[model samples]
Target: MNNYFNSNSVYIEEDFRCRFRMRRYVFERLLHDVQQVNPYFRQKLDRAGRPGFSPHQKVTVALRMMAYGSPADSMDETHGMSESTCLDTLQQFCDTIFQVHKDEYLRKPNQEDLNRLIRKAEDRGFPGMIGSLDCMHWDWKNCPNGWQGGFSGRSRKPTVVLEAVASYDTWIWHAFFGVLGSQNDITVLGRLPFFNNLMEGKAPQLHYYIKNRQYNMGYYLADDIYPKWATLVQAIPNPRNDTEKLFTLH
Candidate 1:
């Protein structure tokens, strides 16, 4: 911990971010928040009266395990923590983090959020666009043998898919993960639970105009792989005219 958090720390802030995946202040804030609710994160004494792991030590190990997908045993030597202890710390850390930040960071978009997203999209020439929808593949290094074939797609390797919707500012309003890689974008879209809100009439109402024609529903910009749906807009495959080409630019 002294190598980074001490007053005379050795490494610089850049090094901390490169290793921890967040700025030092951000990490400190997380540590503070986690400690506030979970006493397990606080430094304590063992039966022998020796000081146990400090808050920074525990939080750092947990972050390393998450950020780099490092195994629990890998931290036994570097951070002087046992494998069992590391696992427990990671679980507690994750639970505490979600408890602290879920309300703001993990929530679905509300009416006000929709308004802000629409205004930003309108400024960029897409008045009715809520966000861009996309999918990405994350390699599954430890996929079970029974499920490997089902998860392996064109990459010929076991993987999982993550679908996300993000506004112009890169604020992710929706995320759906854990779909098998074998599924294409269309298949993934069909399995998305996010549409349940829309189907149930629970989604926020939207109002916007394009060429003086008002639209009540918001749409997402997607790639050609997606089906042609009113809620999804795709660029022209072959833009023959300047107007079509300019429209594609947006």
Candidate 2:
């Protein structure tokens, strides 16, 4: 029988060495942030008789495997660990890393960040645009049987939702991921922490630049999918006539 479905012969290719090293570099950058929040990581590494690899090595290998979608056998072959050991280490690393960096990694933009962004947008004559919001779907390859039912919708495939906010220059300001694909754009937006800030006056004020004149408050830009909010300014649909198109062009 072919070994493709079997785990024994699974192995990483030699050509992937460069890829592995690059992944390790990315993981190292996140390690500082991870160590600050997760006490379990410190405790586990400090404990004696820990059969797995070093905490740093385990985290690096696991994160690389996840981020690159490498198989368990590939990780075992690359990192010189057994397949079962690689699996265990990956599970352990994910649990600890997520717990430690959950808040810091997932936090919404604060007032200061929003203020600076608004100022930058104003400098470019695109005032009142806090951020350009958009969503994308991440294809999921191995969703659990039970989860497949909930994860698939009209797309008929398992997918995770990702929403991002970007500036006029297309630099991402904030991003949230892992929402189920069944969710609509408005449903996802409603759950964003930034929305709460807007409602609670915690977000920075909206500024408008017209005719070298500056006006404060009263507008924001979002896709038409978002319901009208006191602070939101929705773009007009179609821009019906030429005059309307001219107004919409800016």
Candidate 3:
């Protein structure tokens, strides 16, 4: 632990980032937050009155397991913990992080957020654009044999789909995960609840004008696979003229 975290540590910040998949300050902040909320991370004494694992050890083990996909038992020689204990620590760390940070980090956009996103999009030449919508597949390396057929798609591997809408700063305003990988972007959209509020007239209203053409609802920049809905703006697949080329470029 002292090798990277101590004041006179041997490794540099870059080395720490390479090992932890995050900067030292980020890890330290996360550690502080986790320690604040979860008492399980606090060090205690064993039955023989010997000092137990420190919060540092537990957090480091959890991070190593997550960032490197290291097995629970993989830390035995380094951290001197059992596989089951490592698994428990990892689960607790994840739950605590989510519980503590979910509100600010993972929340639906309010009116202010929508307005900011709209302003940014308008400055980029898209008057009513909110963000970009897309789907990606994440491999399920430990997928069950019985569920592999349902999860495997064109990639011929067990996977799940994640649909998200992200803006210029890469802030994900919307995320819908765990869709069958066999599904395409369109199919995933059909099942997404992202539009449910809009359909029910419960979503925030948006108004914008482009060259005297006014629009009431905000839209997303999607790919050609998505349907030609007013709320989605797709680029021209084959631009024929300068005007078309300019539209596609931006």
Candidate 4:
């Protein structure tokens, strides 16, 4: 692990700095919004027990840990903190930051936002693309004892699942995380909040908007693995015949 860390240090540090800077911006935005909508964080900070590390330091350390995937000991050396302090600060930061930001980060996009995205897609060649849906897997170090069953299967290793939606230019619109690794892409997609809204009438306007603008019928692009949903457009089949090859090329 140290060898991996040493070899990758330069690249890791550069990437970590970029993400740390971005996260500071995101955290500040979250802080302002929390003040307006909730006021809970401000109140808690004002009434806290004997103060721990500065919130900004805690947050910076946590973001660096996440972005670099470095162990706490390594983070300590890199950030010039004691190992125990690095570990404790990261744990606290994860707890505090999520508590402050989860609502804003995880909440589904509003109808207006979805409509704007759809319109933007229409402006590009791909019309009615609400977003491009995909799944990504993150390798887990070890399966937790009791939770092993939930996190292991054919892969036989712990993993976390993520589902993301991107625009035509591949800008991620949203990301969902923490589904157990054993689950397949279809299972994860089935459980997504956005998919549920589409099933219910909650996202009806966006559905209707896509239909009106694009194929008259609703459609979205996704990989071959997804079953045909009314709102999803699957890739063309692998080209086996000359006609299929021609179609695929176009």
Per-residue lDDT value at 186 in model 1 = 68
Across 45-122, the per-residue lDDT of candidate 2 in tens digits comes to: 325666535546566667677768778888666677677777876786777766766664445556676677677766
The window of 10 residues in a row where model 2 has the poorest summed lDDT is 1-10
Clashing pairs in 1: none
lDDT of 3 by residue, 113-173 (tens): 8999989988888877888999998788999998998888778888788889899988886
- CA RMSD of all predictions: 2.6, 8.2, 2.7, 7.4
Model 1: what TM-score? 0.88
**Alpha carbon lDDT of residue 1, candidate 2?**
8
TM-score of 2: 0.58
**lDDT order of candidates, top first:** 3, 1, 2, 4
What is the C-alpha lDDT profile of model 4 across 109-142, one tens digit per residue?
5667667777787776555567777777777676
Local distance difference test, per candidate? 0.85, 0.64, 0.86, 0.62
Error of 1 at 151 (Å): 0.7
| Candidate 1 C-alpha lDDT tens digits along 98-202 | 899788769878888888888988888888788899989888899999889888878888888888988887788678875654445667777888865544444
What's each prediction's TM-score?
0.88, 0.58, 0.85, 0.62
Count clashing residue pairs in model 4: 1
Task: Assess the local accuracy of residue 112 in candidate 1 as a C-alpha lDDT between 0 and 100.
Answer: 82
Candidate 4 vs. true structure, TM-score = 0.62
Lowest summed lDDT across 10 adjacent residues in model 4 is found at 37-46
Error of 3 at 48 (Å): 3.8
| Cα misplacement distance, residue 104 of candidate 2 (Å) | 5.2
